[model samples]
Target chain A: MTYTFHWEVPLQNLPLFLWGALATLEISGIAVLLGLLIATCGALARLSKHRLLRGAATVYVEVIRNTPFLVQLFYVYFGLVVVGINLEAFSVAILTLTINCGAYCTEIIRAGIQSIHRGQTEAGLSLGMTQWQVFRYVILMPTLRVVWPPLASQFIATMLGSSVVSQISAEELTYAGMFLESRTFRTFEIFFAIAILYFVMARLFSFLFSLTGQKVFREAWGQL
Target chain B: MRRHGRSWGWIAVLGIVLALAWTASASAAESTLDQVLKRGKLLVGIGLGAPPFGMYDADKKPTGYDVDLAKLIAEELKVEIEWVDTTSVNRIPYLLTNKVDLVIATFGNTPERAKQVAFTKPYSSWNLVLLGWKKDRNIKSYKDLKGKTVAVTRGTTQDIAITKLAPEAKIVRYEDDPVAMLAFEQKKADVMPTAEVLALKKVKENKDMEIKGLVSRSWAAIGVRRGDPDWLQWLNTFMDWHGGQGKFAELFEKWNGVQMPVALPRW
Candidate 1:
């Protein structure tokens, strides 16, 4: 109750916090790119003519989406070590984030692909386009436009969820906050600053996604 | 609509901050001891994560050295005991925020920590050591810890000590003792720095680990909010009185299955 706010503690440790923020962005950025790749493959697999590919994709998505992310992280980081599969905390963090984000993004992407009318695919084929070209030009482009908002939200969620990686000492923004809080015992001040940093990061991600959407879609942006 | 929602979010945050300030100011007038006496209940924080010192028993009830000590303190105050489970990192914040009147959570007394929370005279004592697999004789001293992954509970005495002493050791800090110990057990880390008693317990359960190096002999004490001289003094006197009666030693033996290693000094 008689506590004094040490605003200087966080201010003095700005460099460390910045380094941690960079780590957060680095991990999340890598995860987002890898996750999107996995989601694309997974979406294609789920819609594939091969039953085996569809079944495997379904299992992967269901297994990841059903279980808690923390448990999955622990399994990769801690549980795997018991069987001689030791990995660094940062590597485990990125690995888990990629898989977790991949699972959710797969569902979103699959829904987007499914939303394309069968007539559009038939129309592309009738126009003398190859299968890959039609899939890319007709299905993929419109799918991106349709699912961009949800994918952006999922990407932001993954970035926010990266804070839990600090539990394994991954040295991200939340880890930096914890390190400062441990030293200064300024819990509220440290976490409050961290929350603001996360907010800024999320906003930045949203802005980047919109710019990307507009650039990629071009004239199709508003028309879609 | 977006601007309207944004303004409402700011207003909500302001409201919460003002509420916190109001409660902090209101509680500032009375010392923790006065509050406990007036409320007829002693709110004590204990870490259930650390075994022997603080843990659950066969019945899943909280029963450990720290818990027993807290019970004794509450009895001395003639008040009902209410336990607030805390972890290594949150112990000090719990005291600072008035969530608990005192924390007896295997909190090692350190000069750095003393700045945040007042510590009574030591009620218990233990040595911290770098524990690793018996097969890894390469880790014999602090210098040997170079490039090795050392797991520790975040914000604990051993975490700070190892970070300072063996700066080159890759420290992977978990949120609590159990998680860090689990990481060590799983071999996620090459070594773990923790209480000697905890290390010995682990070594007994699995024949692989042994003490690699000693970090420091630490004294555990009750933590109270800083600036509460009245509460701090009362706790010091309570520890001295009960400690002189060998009650703490008896509880230590009962919970830890060993005699007290170091005689707690009375100032």
Candidate 2:
């Protein structure tokens, strides 16, 4: 109650916070892109006819989903050095984010793939489409339509969870907040500003995802 | 339009309620000294993460230099001690928010922090030094840290100092002392600026690392909320009394395994 609010602190450090926001977006953007690629491949592998491929994807999803993100981040940043794989903190952050979110995305995509009836594949084959063509035309598109909402949520979660990368000094929004808070000691004001910034960024991300979904599934956009 | 007006009315009501609550709390608030005496407890904040200064022992009890110092102060005040675990970044905020009556968590006295909290006379002192591998003989001064990744605990004195002194250096800040030290140990950083005692401990563990350069001599003091002149004066008197009696020196030697300085700067 004796505390005096320093509202000017966040305003004065607005540039740094913006820079941090940019870094947060950069990492989250790259991680989401790479995670999508990994998830698509992992989902396909999980449903592959070959035993080894399915087992590998299953193990990856199980292991990553079971472990905490912080421990995985520490391992990627610190533990990987022992094996002679030295990467910068930013790279380690992106790598860990991609790997961690890839697991969740893989499960999500897998569920979407499974939701497709076997009759759909049979219908595609009866129309004389190749296996790859059937997968591309008959399965993947509808699966994406079915899963876009949850997928968008997961992507947002990944973006928000990117805040944890500040632990490794990745210079993201949360790190900028910590840096400013350290110097100014205006904890409430700084964090209040940071929370608003993060909320704005997350909303921006959600908007972008919705736009992309609308464009990619133009006819089904309304249903989505 | 009706919904908007209703929301505006709600906002007004909420603001008035908050104002009443603030005034109620403000009126209920008393000076830290009076509050402690009246409550029969001294709420002391200490960083349990920093070792030798504050850390859990083998038995999982909080036993360190800062914890011991807090105990001494509580004993002197004839009150039961209650500890609030703090981190480097939260120390000032904790004091400001009245989460703890005082912080004894190896808090470095600096003008910037002094704006937010009152620091007592020095209870312990150490030089902030650049620590790196002994083989890295090229780093002798602040300029030599250019392009090198220096690890630091976020919000610690060394973090501020290194960032200010060697702005070009790639400073990687961890959340706390132990993690920063871990980053340094794991070779995630090329160098680290830390307290001399902590640097010495690291060097003892790994003979390859040594103190490369002294940045500044830092004094750790008890941090109380600002505007509590009476509380500050009482704590300063307690410091002077114990300091004259060599209680601080005794504790310093016991914890740090080095003789205390013959004279510490007083303000």
In the order shown, the candidates' DockQ scores are 0.54, 0.49
Candidate 1 Cα outliers beyond 4 Å, as residue runs: A219-224, B1-26
In angstroms and one decimal each, the interface RMSD of every candidate reads 2.3, 2.8
Error of 2 at B154 (Å): 1.0
**Largest TM-score belongs to which candidate?**
1
Candidate 2: C-alpha RMSD after superposition: 3.0
Cα lDDT tens digits, model 2, B63-86, are 989999999888888999988999
For model 1, how big is the CA root-mean-square deviation? Answer: 2.7
TM-scores, one per candidate:
0.93, 0.93
- Provide the RMSD of all predictions against the true structure, rounded to 1 decimal: 2.7, 3.0
Interface DockQ of candidate 2: 0.49
